[model samples]
Target: MSLPDRKEAEVRRMLDVPHPAVPPDLAARAAERGRRILVRRRAVQAVAWALLLAAVAAFAVWAAVVEPWVVPPADTTPPLDGW
Candidate 1:
């Protein structure tokens, strides 16, 4: 047989072989690992949200104390004061 035919035969042989069975405990182990990862992710997200809320509160307090929304009066240099 030619090279192509030989490669096809090899691939067919490989495909015909049965795959190995999974270990009985593998599913349980995978579920436990997934839960651990999920917990860590949620904890990190919670911390990030708390920090954001803290920053917003601090800004609000500072704004209330400073009254930044009020506009300052215009300065005309005291007309005729130096005359």
Candidate 2:
């Protein structure tokens, strides 16, 4: 048989076999695990947002106190002030 025909025959043979029985509580168990994962994801997102906000507030406070935009005073005096 050709390669494609052999592959098709194999797939047909596999499909003819009976599928295994699933557990009755499989859906419920999967749903419970999904809910737990969602709760954890939401909690992590909330903490991340809170930390981002706190960082922005801290930077604002630091900038206000330090005033980085203003020029600093010169170190040496001019030479001809007295004459």
Candidate 3:
């Protein structure tokens, strides 16, 4: 048989067998694990947001103090006027 037909027949043969018994506490365990994963993900997200805010605040403070956008004064003086 062709590869696709052979794969399909194999899948059908596997599906025909009886399935294994599931653990009684499977749902509870899954729910608890999911809750823990969700909590960890949320905690990480919160920390990331806090760090972003902190970085923004620091940049704001730096910009306020430094005023980097303003042009600097010329270093050399003009020639003496009315000499």
Best by lDDT: 3
Candidate 3 structure quality by residue, lDDT tens digits, 1-83: 99999999999999999999999999999999999999999999999999999999999999999999999999999899887
Tens digit per residue, CA lDDT, model 1, 13-41 = 99999989989999999999999999999
For model 2, where is the 10-residue window of minimal lDDT?
73-82
Tell me which residue pairs clash in candidate 2.
none
- Enumerate residue pairs that collide in model 3: none
- The residue-level lDDT of candidate 3 at 13 comes to 98
- Descending-lDDT candidate ranking: 3, 2, 1
C-alpha RMSD values across all candidates: 3.8, 1.9, 2.1
> In model 1, which regions exceed 4 Å deviation?
1-12, 73-76, 81-83
Scored by lDDT, model 3 comes in at: 0.99
Q: TM-score for model 1?
A: 0.67
Candidate number with the higher lDDT (1 or 2): 2
Best by TM-score: 2
